[model samples]
Target: MTDGASRRLLTTRRSVLCGGLGTVAASAIGMPMGAPAVHAAGRVVKISMQRSSVLFTVLKVRGTLAERLAPLGFEPSWHLFTSVIEPMNAGAVDIHADVADAVPIFTQSAGAPLTFYARERGAPSAEAIIVPADSPIRTVADLRGRTVGVSRGSGSHYVLAAALKRSGLSFADIKPAYLQAPEGAAAFEKGSIDAWSIWDPFLAFAEAKRPVRTVADGTGLTSYHRYYLVNDRFVAEHPEVVSAVYEALSEAGRWVKANPEAAVALLAPVWGDLPPAVVAAANARRSYTVEPVERAQLGEQQDIADVFLEAKLIPRRIDATDVKIFRPSTVKG
Candidate 1:
């Protein structure tokens, strides 16, 4: 993609901008008719969200983010994606709702011009290595020689890798089936795969409907933070949009935690009409506390990058603290 083309892609449009990725584009939330035009002139700010990002999805569905951006003359254009890493890296989107810690590491290694603005604090229990309920894989060690399904470069992938190392095994000990969530779930159900490394709400969904057992979670393996990011170009051009997004995300997360029932009711339908109970269960495992990303907090990210590098999963080594960070106004230096 040319520099001009990439810039154009980052700038939003009334119509679907980038297609062919199975992305479901939601209608652009236009500025209110009487709203004051502040900085930009009703420019659309493209943001991508996955169902796993509970707070982001809630904010999108409830129009909280749209409301926040409207007064600033920025229309919020929401897009549904199973993973936002690629689109953000390609500069196809302006803001990434949230992606796993490992994702940014891989993106950084690829030299994607991305900046971390906010993060959902560590929720170590949200992701795990799940096995058949009756399977004899009693421990992480038992996973050796087993077929394990994982989303390549996901936080859960790092969990599986870390778990294996803790148990005196390496990533090569098992046959890895790199599958997305749907494929992994189906393969796990068919008994074609011995185990799956997955995260909520998929983790909650699997446990609710399938006979599965969690062998190990990220308790001591990984912090499993979810990061909110934006393309570097977007950050440079519209720092106000970035701040609006950060504040909205932080508020949305607080709302979800404070009003669990109402939040579950709102998110259940968005998550393909999942049961409220399941939604609540998934939400419980996640820490919806959004905070600014600081250099000191990047220790684990560097560790994740090193691990992926040692395993040859990422193309090159990355210094996790090398990227830019947008400090929200609420957070003082």
Candidate 2:
């Protein structure tokens, strides 16, 4: 969007939030600039996503990040891909934002150097088992022997498999209908599949448009969620950039929590064509926590890695500790 358009939408968003919409106003205001001001003295970087919210957050400067990055010549350029693993595997993007649980699968399956950096707190059960509103799949175990939709090798796919295991079932117990996000959503609408496992915006979009009901999400059935990941070698060389990105994301998390209503308003334009209530609901469920990587977190990732390895989800096991890089003190403005 042009600077004028972006700012106008931003202003309108603030108004929407302030009108007792319940979301806090965007407090990180900066003098709006006209054009991309990222001609700084650093290497230009490309961030990747599979149509997830973090990708939107990065490019739109959707939250606290806009202010924190205002100082750095760090303008964002978005790169879209089918899955977080593919882009990082190809080494096409320098920074990759993904679910923390997914790190073990790609990094260990392939020698991908992406490491867990920051996390999106309050992870919504967005990526849940969605059955057609009229479907007979009322319980998790009901998913057995049914064809479920998921993207092969994506985080949602992994989570769905993990969810199934909790019911004492495995991939062998059900039919996994492999399809991309859009295709999967469409298939679910047609009742061509028993259920669809997916993440938001798409999850919200599907739920609103189809006779679907959420059967599982990021909760008791599934606790592992996504985390911001940076290229290992890239972060080692450009720690400052890594730090800047983290600080910005941390701030964005704060802003999202503080001003959810405004955040949803700003999100509306991005998702204008979609259902507003879905956006509002999904936004409220998103976990936007900002904390430095801790050993406990690494241990959690390691636990995921072990599960994926046991399931042979990834090609091999990954030593998560070797890649859980963080420098929170330096990631500040």
Point to the candidate with the largest TM-score: 1
The digit string of per-residue lDDT tens for model 1 on 144-200 reads 899999988789989988888889988889999988765676677779999999998
Report backbone clashes per prediction: 0, 11
Query: Which 10 successive residues of model 2 have the least lDDT summed?
Result: 24-33
Model 2 misses residue 237 by how many Å? 2.0
What lDDT does each candidate get?
A: 0.78, 0.63
Backbone clash pairs for candidate 1 read none
lDDT per residue as tens, model 2, 105-223: 56656877666677665364766778988888887799989999987766677678778778888888899898867677667766788988887767777766756777887576445
Taking all chains together, each candidate's TM-score versus the true structure is: 0.87, 0.79
Instruction: Estimate the lDDT of model 2.
Output: 0.63
Q: Which residue ranges in model 1 land beyond 4 Å of their true spot?
A: 1-41
RMSD of each: 7.7, 7.6
Error at 227, model 2, angstroms:
1.0
